[model samples]
Target: MIPPLLSRTILATTLSVIFALPAAAHFQEIIPSADVLPEGGDVTLDLVFTHPFEGGPTMAMKRPVEVGILANGTKTNLTDKLVEQSDKGAVTWRVSYNLPEPGAAIFYVTPQPYWEPAENKYIVHYAKVIVDSFASGEGWDEMVGLPVEIQPLTRPTGLWTGNLFSGVVTKAGKPVPFAEIEVEYVNDSGIKAPNDAYITQVLKADVNGTFNYVMPASGWWGFAALVEGDKPMKSPDGKEVPVEEGALIWIHTSPMGK
Candidate 1:
């Protein structure tokens, strides 16, 4: 019923608006089979680069540049232990680690630079997660000395669903004032977001580079503090592109059962 010229114009506008909408935030996930090892045994870790909230279209991750675990004041390199995993043609990584002692094992990964054509930039997320072994409650705050990292103000593990998680966004061991952090939950329960806005929660750090968020659900929550890299990197097409450095940390929360 509409004029052909006007109809074409409207269709073009609609398509443009849809494409203009921001894509779901990319989270570098370092999920473990268990966050706490009450008895202290082997723990399996899955490393994937994906949109945790939307839950799919996982990006292919090359073998990490570095992977290690810090425990009992010692850092052990585990890069050679990584085994490649594939899902629907996307490459991921997995590692199995044994926790024989009682302490917090902080595992971290420095992934290869990923090129994002949509943003015309490269992404490098330094991600880490803690596995408390035997509930020792010790060494939970040890710094991995990553170039960019989230220094937890609160203990990073064994939390209730409604507990508050707070941390400081630091780059090169110094606070980054008012840093932007993106939070997302790993969608294991098939929960749906009512709108696109709910897919990723955004918050800014305080003047001291501290941020707080109370997770409403019980699952693995990831907080990524995004900051521009100090230097540019060569893109796949040989262009000099800026890098988006994300200091990411993941924590698990359990539901308070009746």
Candidate 2:
């Protein structure tokens, strides 16, 4: 006969495997060193896949399918300049761009499809961030022509912490009705969540596909609008699964002076 304690341990391990879950929100982050620049110069960016609120257990990122910056009415390709960085057995990416002249730099990345065994599907998050240079205040409304993207109703930069952010979720150039958006604040390395569900807040767009969220804290915040793709992708085990298409946008807000 087996000891009761040994029996309990086996049961717990079996349950854990049976219902494996993702610990935090999976965000494809294209974060820059600074969101606003007083003067124009060079800026560095890090492309990572991780739970921003938890800081990370960084997920591996393959070379992105497309990467560029839309500025001065032109899109400049920066894929060749990407540098891969590895941490704790996971890989990420980095790049540096010369922010010449005064204007808005909208950097975007279309990451290669990432397969999640837990969800049993592939995820492709089209992520972007805006940097205001020299307070140029131009091109904040620029669009990247991605398959899925967010059109910011409010100016994407120079925002206050409590200001409301609103944007439309569009796929293939048409607005989606009642889209689902997931929100998360970049945890700045040490913010603790009260519970598992608290790590990622969920919201929905209105009938016109426009969504709003009030900035709750001062720092970088990411909004991801997820939808299903028309096509399905094959999994490693040879099963065809639906593809998750996400349109993600990032913005930074400042707190009032103390």
Candidate 3:
């Protein structure tokens, strides 16, 4: 009869084999159904296998591997990572990350090889994700709405030490070069955070309707970029040149707002 300790060791080895089979199979992909993700929301990236080891004779009897989410540049490992099992031979892994700014996020899945490195090896594949602006809203009309382009030129966020407000102005459709710009203050209601409050700054587009200007104040500010030509070449009652659609306006309020 086999000793009890020997039997227990065999059982443990069997379980490990079952779980390590999938990793040995080949390369896979985990995550991001759509390229563009809604900003500031829970992001769930699904894990899927691919070439090097999709479903085929190469695949082993047991399938298990590691998956993870890479936000901005940080690596969040999620392999062999355990989750409550609802049924048999099933597993799930999930994580959440907050993206405050608009930009791209990347994810990768690394398949681990169970066998020796010389004979078989594991690899990883990457996927790109884009986080859209939070300011977008139902009220925002593509044909005509407030401009969302707001960027710093020289002095990025702080007390006003000098005179110079410089930044590029881009509308939804095309870049607004030398656009007629204006600055003002709007009450902040959306973002409760003082730093995110709406402050106003007006900028005039350059010869191409792109705007680059400066503000004298250090408080929060906002801006409105209108496409009306310089000097309104036509009389008010005369044929009115239509204002281009996708005109943009940006609003910001600093902590100093009263």
Cα RMSD to native, each candidate? 2.1, 2.6, 26.2
lDDT order, best first, reads 1, 2, 3
Look at candidate 2 and tell me the lDDT of residue 65.
Answer: 91
Q: Pick the candidate with the highest lDDT.
A: 1
Q: After superposition, how far is residue 145 of candidate 2 from its true place, in Å?
A: 0.6
Per-residue lDDT, model 3, residue 53, is: 13
Q: Which ten residues in a row have the lowest lDDT in candidate 3?
A: 137-146
Ranking by TM-score: 1, 2, 3
Candidate 1, residues 1-258, lDDT tens digits: the string is 999999999999999998879776998999999999999999999999999988877999999999999999999999999999996689999999999999999999999999999899999999999999998888999999999999999898899999999999999999999999999999998898898889999999999999999999999999999999999999888999999999999999999983
Candidate lDDT (C-alpha), each: 0.95, 0.91, 0.36
Residue-pair clash count for candidate 2: 0
Whole-model alpha-carbon lDDT for candidate 3: 0.36
lDDT of 3 by residue, 56-114 (tens): 22222123343444444455565545232221232323334544654434333333322
Give the residue spans of candidate 1 off by over 4 A. 1-11
lDDT of 1: 0.95
